[model samples]
Target: MRFIIDVLLTGLAIFLAALILPDSAVSIAGFGWAILAGLIIGFVNATIGTVLRFFTFPLNLLTLGLISFIITVLMVQLTSYFMGSKFDVANFWWAAVFAIIVALIELLLNSIFGSKDRD
Candidate 1:
């Protein structure tokens, strides 16, 4: 189904991001762990991320949307925490870098393979 495809694509993006970064920056156990990490990332982003964004909307406006990016980086850190050693991010800057990489890769993959309805 579409949801499964999205999850797989996200997983691929996460795995690719890990491979693209230095070992100390970001690392995942393997593709399988990446998939689970992707799922957790989605959940966290959907639940806690949403609330945080809503509350920080004022800061987001004042910062010209910079706060949104910070929220995303935090989401990555939270995902790493949930994934334990399976998915590791070294520090705030590294998490920010990892988030950017994952977003870029996910955008590319979704544009190529995502369902037509999404477009």
Candidate 2:
């Protein structure tokens, strides 16, 4: 299903974020928690992220892609909040680094999987 594909992509993204960010840590409970975190993250992005993006359209236009990095940080923070876990980044810089790494990993996976559209 589409939902499952999206969750998988999100989990991969989170896993990559954990790997790239030195301060971030992920528990090894199992795939279930990762999938749950991914679902929560996707839901937050779909709902809260969309509204935030719409409200910040002008800022986004002015700052170009820089706003995207901020958005990613916010999304990361949101994920942490929803999952009731901590993503301890050194600072915004580390968060930015982690976000970029996650994005790249997710893009690679999506490409290999031919995207969620096929699900």
Highest-lDDT candidate: 1
TM for candidate 1 is 0.93
| Count: clashes, candidate 2 | 0
Which one is best on TM-score?
1
Model 1 residue runs over 4 Å out of place are: none
Span of ten consecutive residues with least summed lDDT in model 2: 21-30
Q: For model 1, which pairs clash?
A: none
Q: Candidate 2's error at 41, in angstroms? A: 1.8
Q: On a 0 to 1 TM-score scale, where does candidate 2 land against the true structure?
A: 0.75
Q: Which ten residues in a row have the lowest lDDT in candidate 1?
A: 110-119
User: Model 1 has how many clashing residue pairs?
Assistant: 0
lDDT for each residue of candidate 1 in 1-119, tens digit (9 for 90 to 100):
78888889989999999999999889999999999999988888889989999999999999998998998889889999888899999999999999899889988997899653773
Q: How far in Å is the alpha carbon of 66 misplaced in model 1?
A: 1.2
Task: Write one digit per residue (lDDT tens) for candidate 2, span 40-101.
Answer: 66677788888888888899999995775687677766676655643344456665666677
Deviation of model 1 at 27, angstroms: 0.6
